[model samples]
Target: MAGTELFGTIEMVDVFLAMAITIVIASFVSLYRGIEGPGIFNRIIAVNVIGTKTIVLLVLIGFIYERPDFFDIALLYAILNFIMTIAATRY
Candidate 1:
């Protein structure tokens, strides 16, 4: 039973790590799109998506690291990302 529990915990950790890596890769792709996009609107959208993915990745990292403080940062990032997206669209 103990071995099974340990295995489950390890599996969870692995999954979380995988998710983090995926998000990071996605962010990089978004960043590339944002940089190389032909139109301003497309670049803005890509940047917004990158910001959202970054917030999610941050939250996931906090969970993996067992630090709740990082969640606050993630929340701030979410709020800022939303505001920036709105501002970008308006401009």
Candidate 2:
């Protein structure tokens, strides 16, 4: 039973890792959009999307690693991301 439980945990971690990788790839796409966007608003929105995805990725990584501190870091980063977006729009 313990072996089966361990295997299940491993499988879940694998799933989290795959999700993290997908988020990374999507972030890259957002990066490209930010670079080549037609307008300032479009670029700002792209950057915001990347930041949001990064927050999700951080949480996923924290789950996979069983690290509680990562959650705090993710939260702090999320606040920063939000402020940055607002500031970018204002400026």
**Number of the predicted model whose lDDT against the real structure is largest:** 2
Look at candidate 1 and give me any clashing residue pairs.
none
User: Ten consecutive residues with minimal summed lDDT in candidate 2?
Assistant: 1-10
Please, what are the lDDT tens digits per residue for candidate 2 over residues 1-91? 1122336457667777889999999999889989998989998899889989988998998888888899999999999999998898788
- In candidate 1, residue 29 scores what lDDT? 79
Per residue, candidate 1 scores C-alpha lDDT tens digits across 4-87 of 233545756566779999999988978998898899988889988888899989888887777889999999999999999898
Candidate 2: regions farther than 4 A off: 1-10
What lDDT does each candidate get?
Answer: 0.84, 0.86
What's the lDDT for residue 59 in model 1? 89
